[model samples]
Target: MNHEFSVAEVMTTQGGTMCQYTEMTDAARKRVRAMHNWRRSQLALGNVQNGRNNYNCSQAANMYKMKYDCDLEKSALDYAKQCTLTPSVAYNQGENVHVGPLENDKTKAIATVGEKCTHWSTVIRSSEKKGYPGKTVNSTFFQAVKAWWGQIFRNGVNQRMIFLQNLRDKPNAPIAWSQMAWALSTRIGCAVVNCQSNTFTVCRYRQE
Candidate 1:
């Protein structure tokens, strides 16, 4: 897939202003939820590795199982439709977005019901881009959420007495992961939209 991104907003095409919308189907949503819970279960079971060195990370004592929320999906879709790089989710919600060229033939019918439109491949070539070094990019929406959960590799549970508080002060704090594991955040919602030649994905988590 191409790394070059499109500057055209989801609301406007290169030729004119218009909006095209596509949404996740029931099957897609179920798969997304399964992906999330499976990754979280890995951490809860201490079966995760650090992206930095493939080192083993400690486990979570009580990672909550996540549920899909249509309200959050609506909120995420509301922002995703804009297809902006900047995050503007509600103050009490956490958000993650990915933008890139739509290349995989499977994703071409992303708007169609029951289409196999999940997962893609990419490489994260810079630690500077992601605040840590890694060979693979979390190209799937579920993998994107898993990336947030991966902060344990860098900011382990023993880092501080109040980890999340200290983490927020860091230059490249893992806010997404923190939110993902925010014990109280039991709900999530996500959406994907095609903007001409690019794909925009956004996910929202309930925040405490």
Candidate 2:
């Protein structure tokens, strides 16, 4: 039997495959939640407290104003909101599934979805970019995320902290569309998200 994948199963010149979008949102939410979880931690530790924390406390209650939600801290709650509220399924579908967004929609989508799409291949080459001392390109999802994390997260965030923070119990940011394509090409697969001008960056999270 000669079984063949449909248009949605394979990536094309147009954009990301259906599976890629699914992976995109999934990876994105986890990552953001993880960020919030750690940010909350930093607040508790008084690391980012600016002038607070004369005394050292390792937990949130002792450090924060005690703003609690069903036992979770404001940061954790906020993390939940971000994950729940953010768009999960990519907007377009079917033959137009791989279609990229229009130039104008780039900013709007960024605001609404908190994530924008782009090509995964470009970002993969980043291993060769400056600040990335890795001798070779084409890194793994973890490595790619590590390299781009600094660029995406700056406010005094360092490479060491990125790895250290995820150790806590929170979901990491979601895998982006572009990253999704390369990260699991042989698996669920990927394709162009839309045919409109590639105005968006694949799976880029908005800063602040």
Predicted model with the maximum lDDT: 1
Error of 1 at 82 (Å): 0.6
TM-score, per-candidate, Cα-based: 0.61, 0.21
**Candidate 1, residue 57: CA error in Å?**
3.7
User: Model 1: runs farther than 4 Å from truth?
Assistant: 1-22, 50-55, 103-143, 146-162, 169-172
Ten-residue segment with the worst summed lDDT in candidate 1? Answer: 115-124
Minimal lDDT window, size 10, model 2: 92-101
Off by over 4 Å in 2: 1-23, 49-208
lDDT of 1: 0.50
Clashes of each: 1, 34
The alpha-carbon deviation from the true structure for residue 124 of candidate 2, after best TM-score superposition, in angstroms, is 18
Please, what are the lDDT tens digits per residue for candidate 1 over residues 1-208? 3333322121112221111223445544556567777877876676766435545546676678888888777777676556555537376676666554444422322322221011121111111121211111123454445455666566554322134455466655655555555555688777655444455566677743
lDDT of 2 at 60: 35
Clash count in backbone of candidate 1: 1
RMSD of each: 10.8, 17.2
